[model samples]
Target: MSNWVEGQVKEIKWWTDSLFSLILNADVEPFTAGQFTKLALQVDDKRIARAYSYVNAPSDPNLEFYLINVAEGLLSPQLAKLKAGDTLMIERHATGFFTVDELPASEQLLLLSTGTAIGPYLSMLVQGDVWQKYQHVHLVHGVRCNADLSYQDKIKQLQAVYPQLIYTPVVSRESANLGLNGRVTEVIKNNRLFDLMPHCVTPSNTQFMICGNPQMVKDTTALLLDRGFTRHRRREPGNITVEQYW
Candidate 1:
């Protein structure tokens, strides 16, 4: 059977000129924190589809997704104009390789993402799965500005409730009382991820999950590998797991 499920758009909120959010009424199918579902759309009596990651955790009744608006793109262009009571389609099955399950148990877990790519990481964080498996959960999200730093309250709450969880927001374009500033890879290169930790987070005990731009993943993966982190696989376990946002 096809994995897609039919869903309706209960609401829409713009995050930035090129970013938006969607809320749907669907009992989320059972999924790991870093999985994604394909969203189907209809245009002029023809049905089409686009995949989006869940930004909300399973504990939440309403399914939420953070989206990036491609101004010239087909689905996103139409999607951005939608309002509550609008119609859409969702797949029943969700899948991805960037969840905690891909990494072996470790002392420290780093969740790295940028832009809407932070969606899956947020999903995993709110699921309460990382806290159960690791002693330290560090979430590093890179954006262009403060407005791009979505889920501010959610991240703060999670970190506060779970003292072991560390939330770090990195912005590369704008600064000035806007929290940490720099690209995710640049921060890792500049020894920033380690700076936020109360103690050193080393490759010997740290497992990383990276998402967002492919370049970000590549650079961060290269850095981690140099520090002794490995790319995990079905059989062989490694320290770094990446999900390409596109």
Candidate 2:
């Protein structure tokens, strides 16, 4: 890892009391759509840093990060307090291979995520490569409440522009007219998710990209494996690519 590079905060978009997106102007090496970078800030005289996935596409001039303010977290609380013109530290290199190009060619692409894990998928969606390769794309975002479903309008706008794109939001806690009311795993388990896709989300025809809560990732991965999907690896490229949000 490289020493931290300083970047100036360009903007901050707070979607809820605890969730927000940060935009920074930084110069760094190019990275793939789903790659992540380290962010740091001085707190209590200590340089606190954490890895965050990029929300902006690789082509974007500004770097964007979707973050959650954990009441007890050391870094997030400080990150949430940042304003435009504030200095933020970032790694010189972007890292991770959680991208669509890692998977084999498929007819359909499914992006499953929860909470801020939707960040990386949003980066991938804005890139032309994903749409160019797959005939259909499905993005499912799951949150505890409808209010936590950030970037909903942006996703819907993408859906409106792309006939092959399907955007489904799932709320697990409260009844939401904006989205399906259920856990994401339950929605997938009951075939409610597939109903929204233009093509059947099958192991043979679709490639799965899952990111978010570790437990949800574990359960969903197990479910997919049981139904015949294979996990991607260097030696054997498969139907599913996963990134667990810790």
Candidate 3:
């Protein structure tokens, strides 16, 4: 067998206009819900590696990941061309710090994501840990329009049963009766991020997870810090956990 075996592409699903999910039959031990894995593509005699966050539950035998097709990415160009039978290299090890396992227990889990950065959050939710820990799980996703609101059916179904899980879609421009009509930072500045929790994200019993654009990550991190939320790190532990993928 090849040391780096080819993972079989099993399933493909589109969440939104720009997001797509692919399932691969990766041969490896189970990874944590919020870890990332690298994908390799053959170029001449060398292999190119690109890291991607997991978007599936670890209990599942096969590996799955969500991706946003960026027109300029060299690897994404070939990754998008894959089909059910097609093959792509899957890394044996999965790693990342952006998981619910790192942060301390809290009453509220504020998952603020943008674009394709919502991958890990979705994985966390699908794994059932989101509702397991927090009394209230609030997901504030920022996108361009309703068409960008991926996982609508799945998110809504979760909200229907678990009223504790709330989803607020923030659209910057296109808003045809979708959700909030502005950028997520503007919403946070207006105290919208705390509307889900009665007491807000205080150091007492709230935690934050932010992903997406660099500006958004920076602005939201500063805003949370001003509100008494500290960054969660391996050394200096705080209430906020962030993974900047911009």
Candidate 4:
């Protein structure tokens, strides 16, 4: 009864110099839409692993993981070199509490993410459950530059299918002609972010799911708290939910 299973690399999609997505074929157990699983590789007779959220829907035949090749990292560098047909180790069961089912009832659902942290939200979006649960769903992805905005076609496809799905891309380094040209927290603080949304954000109507780098998550949580939002818990249901990537 081993916990690890073999996953064959089906494809590798390179979006940028540091960003990539691994499409793998593995017989993983049924996972919730927003859950994450660990991938491992043997390095110097030792096993190196890292947790990565699934980008594909749970029902999809292929298991997909979005990742960034961290410079001077241990596991990611090896993972980045993997090719189609190569085998890797994947945990048999996915785990995480970041699914939509964990949220409290709200009219609006805001999914804010940065970099590769957008993987889980993409999972939830494509799974088709969020659209039915919330009247309006906002997906805000904050990136350093326009080139870091990966999965545009997939997001556009979901937008077409679900008209209520609002996507706001925040490019901080340079001007984003189509999107906001500031950090997500800055835009929200200055009231520029909500300008693109269909309705105003209130603690009563909005449930925030913020996932990204630790700094972005921390700052975003603090900003929301300042606006009267509280951290969500099963015993004490509140507005903001968060998951930090690295």
Candidate achieving the largest TM-score: 4
Q: In model 3, what is the error at residue 63, expressed in angstroms?
A: 2.3
lDDT of 4 by residue, 14-121 (tens): 999999999999988999999999999999999999999999999998999999998899999899999999999999999989999999888999899999999999
Using TM-score as the yardstick, the better of models 2 and 3 is: 2
Off by over 4 Å in 2: none
The alpha-carbon lDDT assigned to residue 186 of candidate 4 equals 95
lDDT, residue 190, candidate 3? 84
Listed per candidate, the RMSD to the true structure in angstroms reads: 1.8, 1.4, 2.1, 0.8
Writing each residue's lDDT as its tens digit, candidate 1 over 1-246 gives 656566777888776787888998864478777788887788889886788888878767578889888877878888888899887778877787767766789888888888888888888877877876788888877888888887778887887888888778898887824558778877888896678876677667878888889998888889888877789887887777878888
Q: What's the true lDDT of residue 190 in model 1? A: 80
Better of 1 and 4 by lDDT: 4
lDDT of each: 0.80, 0.89, 0.80, 0.92
Compared with the true structure, model 3 gives a TM-score of: 0.91
- Cα deviation at 212, candidate 1, in Å, is 0.5
Task: Give the TM-score (vs. native) of candidate 4.
Answer: 0.98
The Cα error of candidate 2 at residue 151, in Å, is 0.9
Candidate 2 residue-wise lDDT, 148-232, digit = tens: 9899777877887787888888999999767688988898889888888876667779899999999999999998898898998
